[model samples]
Target: MRDSSSSSSKPVLTIGLCFLVALLEGLDLQATGIAAPHMAKAFALTPAMLGWVFSAGLLGLLPGAFIGGWLADRLGRKNILIVAVLLFGGFSLGTALADSYATLLVARLMTGLGLGAALPILIALASEAAPEQLRSTAVSITYCGVPLGGAIASIIGMAPLGEDWRVVFYVGGIAPIVIALVLVVWLKESQAFRAQTGEKIAGQGMLAQLFGPGHASRTLLLWVACFFTLTVLYMLLNWLPSLLIGQGFSRPQAGMVQILFNLGGAAGSFLTGRMMDKGHARRAVFIAYIGMLAALAGLGLSTSFAFMLVAGFVAGYCAIGGQLVLYALAPTLYSTQVRATGVGASVAIGRLGSMAGPLAAGQILAAGTGVGGLLLAASPGLVVAAVAARALLARRNRQPQ
Candidate 1:
């Protein structure tokens, strides 16, 4: 009974709401990273222990992705999204209050569970709400919250905010509470989803579909893409400031460069997501990955600060934009029956990279591989991602487009 035009426009409003939610989600995702140094000092943590605090959330994410996807399929995306917001918001507050490292780590991991579920549900709902013609744009805009949140956290957390790094967590946690309330009131359930999976045919759900024959390979491929992308991306974000400082920049200069790195990601998300709508999600991703490689190489090889900034900008742009646009591609490749599962699997797999990237980078640093060598080591993932992207695109294009 809904008018077609109205239906199309409604999705935009939903996208906007979800976009804000996505922003909060992104902030929560990186909130720990931004506050890590201060938190470490407060807890008297060792470097290795501090590293665990940073990655603790990711541990929660692995199960979170699977459960979130499954829950979305069973209970509906709206229900799970609302719950995720509440979950993340509460954890953010809890994280802020923790006086001990153990408590803080638990809070982060709990927050990660909310984040894991939140992402796939948001991407799925946004993509499903949009008319097929506008699908990529919708997904990308929602996803844009990732970098936008990252940038905001990086910028805001830099403030002195008195002694406690916990203030960052408090702020990060509370923002989502307001957003979740808004979503509960304003956001609409995805009609496309209702139509696609209406009244449940008895047999289909998350598990059955993921393990089904037609879906397993595509699901695995997306996972590989996420794993490598996250591994490299997190390593870059976590280490870039030190790397820059070691390259002869002052502390403030290194910090400024890190901000630029995140800003570039925001720009790339906007560009790559919109471009994906024009068709060739794979090809666009391929180009982004190639750019990521080139950017990292330039950043590593160049001596000038100006050049390093440009390289960092490009690397941040392509690395994040290319990697995340693949999430948008998820809904397209699978029917609603398997959408959440497929997306969840991909994200859950990628969480492995999130855990591994920093750990691996730390090892390389310990072994005395300089920043240049580290950057160089990370370049191959992009290359592999580029090839994977092309194959995925060619496969997708061959379908009845």
Candidate 2:
């Protein structure tokens, strides 16, 4: 395995490639959501049917994260990531070709598998390459690619991409294939990871090591935090556009609001990531969650288009932004040997919440709950996550530094 530690060249290249990977993840994952309304029309889907379309993909992510991260620990980050990129990209292209709801469901599940596998490896590689002092900032900077991709998806949806929606997947599918080729040539295994040897890592399963003695409490809290934060974040990602359309915004206007939300998310990730590097990881994230809670409450009360856009931006800033910080922070909880596993497990657990978000929202919507009511319902999750972040910070503070 080649190590990037000796020169900035490898680390920089690794982060850059991983960033592109994150962008692809966002684009492909959000595709179904972005295409949902049109897809519903084409397939004559009920609200419940559409919700399952949103969920099948997320549910697939669970196993992918667990299995992919486990493999990365033994096989190497570069190896698993390449496979993942190819897997999702190809499946996404297949999704573009689907004619029926069942076909679309299966294709999204396959795409989700590939999508899920790549993420933990990407986080692990970025963390491994970043210096200890700047890890949070570096990973968050890299993580910004996610929202950037989401914004791009919103752009495509708003554009005359046509009601077919297949064109969106075509574009998303192609980008990752190109990126996977680039990774093969430029991305290498982490230096710290390289020194450790697979023999040592193979001695214990990544999942077992993740929950092993000293890591238990933090792991549980991290899982809890991830569950609630991602619940709100993904609920928005998968359903916000539809929610807005229901509120009477034009399709383009809804698309634009989603764009603003993701762009705000990118900005939030950039700023708070740096804050985490400056000894405010806990407070910064806690504050971000608090911001999200307030924004969600405001959203529940507001009916104006302008106010909704502003609230969407603020909510994305806190929820999606703080989620990226969680990605950066997860690896810190474990040793190099299990870092990928830790990140992967957090993501896998988080996907449970992600999987439920759209379905839960769908039920509410179907039951005659307005978008405001749904937003209000979502607020408690953010509040719980906010409390958890404060607890996590206090716990870490009392123990050592």
Candidate 1 at residue 110, lDDT? 96
Deviating ranges (above 4 Å) for candidate 1: 1-8, 196-208, 211-213, 246-248, 301-303, 399-401
Model 1 C-alpha lDDT per residue in residues 123-221, reported as the tens digit of each score: 888888888887878887887788778777777766764466677778788888888888888888877567766555344555455545655566666
Name the best candidate (by lDDT). 2
lDDT, candidates in the order shown: 0.77, 0.85
**TM-scores for every predicted model:** 0.91, 0.95
lDDT of 2 by residue, 123-167 (tens): 888888988998888788778888889999998899765566888
- Ten-residue stretch with the least lDDT total in model 1: 199-208
Worst 10 residues of 2 by lDDT: 198-207
Pairing residues by index, what is the TM-score of model 1? 0.91
How far off is residue 173 in model 2, in Å? 0.9
lDDT of 2 at 166: 87
lDDT of 1: 0.77
Clashes of 2: 0
